[model samples]
Target chain A: MRVQFVLQEIWIGLRRNLTMSISLVITVAIAMALFGTGLLINKQVSNSTNYWYDKIEVSIFMCTKTSSNTSCNKADATQEQKNTIKSDLEKLPQVSAVEYESKDAAFARFKDQFSSTPGMVQSTKAGDIPDSFRVRLKNPEEYKSVSSAMLGRPGVDQVVNEQEILKKFFRILNGLQWAALLIAGIQVIAAVLIVGNTIRLSAFNRRRETGIMRLVGSSNMYIQLPFILEGAIAGLVGGILAAFLLVLSKIFLIDRLQGSLQFASQLSWSSVVGIIIFSVCVGVLLCALASFLTLRRYLKI
Target chain B: MIHFDNVTKVYPSQNRPALQHVNVAVEKGEFVFLVGPSGSGKSTFLRLVLKEERPSQGHVHVAGKDLSRLNNWKVPHLRRRIGCVFQDFRLLPNKNVFENVAFALEVIGKPRRFIGKVVPEVIDLVGLEGKAHRMPDELSGGEQQRVAIARAFVNRPMILLADEPTGNIDPATSIGIMKVLDRINRTGTTVVMATHDAAIVDAFRKRVVELEDGRVVRDQSRGVYGQAY
Candidate 1:
């Protein structure tokens, strides 16, 4: 094949349909960016789940003098009740380890956790946080057993499983991921249709050339090479744009979310780069394939 | 170099067969004029030689290969050995005359220097020497047809098929076009041209095969175009 001839043909085809080509590039870029974002959200969700699942602990808060529960009756649990509760939690197979936090220690831990916000630290008194037992489960999924056993005990005000809260947060992240992927799916369909339309129009415009080529014994592949390369070039440009969009999304969207949420693990730069490469490849392949199929129908040779 | 054995062509949408039970042979270096009315399958006969349309029931052999058995991938190879010209002078409107002629070689992957040498030579042969830089729109109908013929003949194929090469040109201009085809025929390329011009046929006195309503009514050697049978 004459490389220069094919390249010249591609240049002519693209220039002839400049507006359509621009729109095709933009559509492909949006589709690929959303696709990359979906993948990034997928990565973020998995990273957070891995980072947080292992550290999940079920907290069993004991009654204090301020507690008005039926079991506590606005009185602090006695020493015997505390011992009994801690011993019971330790006896459960699901409970791996138990650490008791006194009221003063709980208040100190709260201050330490909220140290970034001085207003929250200043408003919380020592007695505001009740004493609690932090239970680590061998299997986080078995938190139900430990929580059920500890709830409504004479010394216990309430039991909370950290994994449940994490599940809710992760659920929201999963919804966002699905939403991104869904929009990406629609955009991909749009991009593919545009690629097909562009190819058909180009083929129609150059029907005279192609007819002459067919008469001169030019092979089908020789005739199709320029059109296919046209799509691939458009795809390459769009993919480059999408790479920029993906990087920006990581910096302004994901990293910012991590900054505010403070629990999601950091997404590595290398992984973002990897996702960018994958999205670009997908864009190129999709465009090439779409044009190829379109040509098969519109171009007889 | 071209043979049709009991050939028949039937299009799916029409009840009438385009060409029916036709048998004819044109040897190498023969200039044969296929004289027929509009629906008499003159174009179909030329199309069969180019493998553009297949005979629904018979066989077509070009360069001694059975066209029915020719694989789809091998069709281009078969077409490369045969040149075809259409009534429309299917030249790329955007390309100049030289570029249009060179496009044939370029599409088939000919080298630049080789195209540079042969394109102008063929343009000179077709009597379009200094008009190489003009586009199709700038050239007259006869000049455009000459460019189309040049493109078809550039690769030096063994056979040339012309379907109404003079269909749209004036009589004076068509005479020039026929002279070009005649010159190409002298170089040992078998030329089968379909035309309704009885005057050119009688003037050339080449072998004439006349068709009427899909069947060969007469085949005469060095014959003039006869009246409708």
Candidate 2:
């Protein structure tokens, strides 16, 4: 019976302040959407990092006969020098696998990659391709160690790690993630304040009813339950809307963007689901907190 | 039952006490009238009994619980035994008459079945049976006061405190309200009314306690108003 009364009170209270309820819902929805976007971007960064880093390799470009640099004066490496370099690389504890790519083999691989791009294919000459050792390590962090060891070695002109080129990419992504997160934080604070003030106004309007409730021996929880539920219900509706927006963004925007940037096609569906769940939880919890704080003074039930 | 043992209440930012050192007692099922001019501590005395304001210098005992020792959590339990009606009517403007009365029983956790039966009975007792569906704003001042009365009595509390309940109504309506209160008092509910209405005081001639400058100037059975001065 008490539960029924409380539900009735909540229903009536919501109906009484319909405009405030809608405002609360919109505030929560926008905040959750911003926060959800930040989460999705953060997830995307992690996924891309893991995907690219796992395939990252240190490439040791062998000296060529026509190379002008003093480091390549000896010209092409002999079979004995190649065997010695390969054996030395295997001796390192961090060395997981070392594969040799001859100059002809490197040219063939390049041609296959740019086969569809005639402009890129015609731009590269056969002799321009460098014979290299594609070195894979047990951990991506060991790239620096392997690259340093391979540099200035006999018949080696330049040693490059693909991970270095992608470092700047990750840094930019990380900065964007932080920027989105900052915006989310600001929106969340504004949403909380809006929810608090709305509930406060509702409390003020019903001050007489609350006073009577207090006078009639109603417990504090009994009086606060309806208001808190009001905020939470608004928040829940907002969160679901935000989640729908996020899912739509993933399906439409992110999918289209990834289609153009094919390397990121592997972004996980699980991450999107995780973001939606997190956003909903934040929406409900923060609104409940704001409502509780607002009611602290008014009800005193 | 209520007892005030030399209770004194000093309001904040005031040079003098609102309720000077005074004492009084009223047994269960008794109807007492507290009469005084404005700022004579009549409201303060009622507030003291309600525990809304604490007596600064003495003890106030109601229903055997010392008001001074009652903590915040226990205040609600104490209030459950007492019903309060105000001059403002204090009905939720949006609620209909039935909801106003039902709210009293609702706050006390009365079952829906009990509330449905008791609310109508109380509304009938207050002669507001036809006005149950009307909002407070739509009702006349007399009807609104009757709704307030019904809300006060719906819980069947041991004590009912009315602070100028008829202050907003005309003489005829005031008499009607008094008759309803008299009917409730007949049912063994102790009644403490704080009012300055001389005519009502003289007509009922109950135990009247009059205050002057925070001091009790008169206490008499079958008394008339304005006798203290």
Candidate 3:
């Protein structure tokens, strides 16, 4: 019976403070949306680092007539020179596998990789792309060992480790994730302040009722329940709205990016599901904490 | 039912104590009038019995429980045995008369079945039988006080504390409110009222405990409201 009464009281309170409740719902939704975006960015950064680092290779470019390196001043690498270089790379314990790419094959792979960037793909000629030996490492962290060994070798123009390029990309991703997190933090604090103010206002407006209730022997918990429930309802509504916006953004934007940029790793289904659940829980938990703390401070009864 | 042993209450922000070494006791089922001029510690006396304010140097015992020794969590149980009414009536503006009365029992976790039976019975006893559906704003001051009285009595408290229950109403309404208190007292509920209404105090002819500057100046059985010094 008391539960029923409390529910009725909560409903009445929400209705009476409809505008405040609506603003609270919107604030929580926006805050949680930013939080969800931060989570996604963090996951993307980790996923890309793991996905790319495992497949990253060190490329030893063979000398050609267009090459400027003094080390590659000689004629194009012969079959014997190529085979000997490949054998030497394989002899190194850190070298997992070595594959030779001719100029034709390099051009073909470049075209395939940049197919979506039609302007850049069309600008490249058959001979413009370099012929090189792609060396996979047992541990990507050992890229330094392979690059130093291949550098200055006869008939080699350049030794480029894919991990170096990936490192730069990951640095930018990490910075972006941190920036997103900072934004989310500010927004969550804003949402909490609004919620606290709304609770305080509601408590002030109902002081007469609470004063009477206290005089008639009502417990503190009984007086606080309705206000707490008011906050929770706003949070629950905001959580639902945030989840919807998150999923909509994923479907309309992220999914399209995933389709066109197939080489980049996408977020896993289970992790996305976890994010949705986390968004809802965080919203409710934050509002509950805010409400409880504010009420304890301001509600005399 | 109520005892104050050398109770002295010095409000922290005030230079003078609200109650100073005051001593008073009321037996069960007695009607007592706590009469005093403004700021003579009548409100403080009632507040002490309610445990709303603790005595700075002494102890208060109400309904067989020592309030000074009572845990804050256990204060509610002590309060449940005491009913309080005020000059303002303190009725919830949104709720009607019946709901205002039923709210007292509802808060204490009383069974709905019990509330359903006791609320109407008490409302009838307060003689607002047909005004149960009227909101507090829709009723006269006397009727509103009756609703407050009904709420206090619906819990069947052992002691009823009224801090100037008739202060806001006219004399005609004041008499009606007093008669309701009289009726409730006749049913064996101890009554303690704080007021400045000399005529009502003199007319009731009950035990009057008058305070002067936070000290009890008079304690007379069937006393009259005294003249100003």
Best by DockQ: 1
How good is model 1 by TM-score?
0.95
RMSD of each: 2.1, 3.4, 2.0
lDDT string, candidate 2, B1-229, tens digits: 9999999899989989898888999899999999999999989988888888888899999998898889887888888889888899999887899998898778768888999888999999999878889999898998899999898888889999999998989999899999999999999999999999999999998999999899999999999998543
Q: What do the candidate models score in CA lDDT, each in turn? A: 0.93, 0.86, 0.87
| Alpha carbon deviation, residue B185, candidate 2 (Å) | 0.8
Better of 2 and 3 by lDDT: 3
What C-alpha lDDT does candidate 1 achieve relative to the native structure?
Answer: 0.93
Per-residue lDDT tens digits of candidate 1, residues A1-301?
4999999999999999999999999999999999999999999999899989888899989888787788888888888999999898888988899999999999988897788899999987898799989999898899887888888888889899888888898999999999999999999999999999999999988888898888899999999999999999999999999999999999999998898778557999999999999999999999999999999999997
TM-score of each: 0.95, 0.88, 0.95
Which sections of candidate 1 miss by over 4 Å? A65-68, A78-80, A87-93, A102-126
lDDT of 2 by residue, A1-301 (tens): 8888778777877788889888878878888987888777777778888888788888888888766669778577676777878899989899899999988899999898778788998988886788888889899888888888888888777888888877877787678778777887988898888888878877887788889998777767777888898888889999999998888878775676566544554667898988899899989989988999988865565
Worst 10-residue stretch by lDDT in candidate 2 chain B?
Answer: B220-229
lDDT by residue for model 3 (A1-301), tens: 8998888878877887789889999989988877886787678778877788789899999987777887666567677778889899989999999999999999999998888789998887887777999999999989897888888877788999887887786786677667767887888898899889888888888888777778878887888988998888889899899898778756764566557644378787678778978998999989988999999899865
Winner on lDDT (1 vs 3): 1
DockQ of each: 0.73, 0.70, 0.70
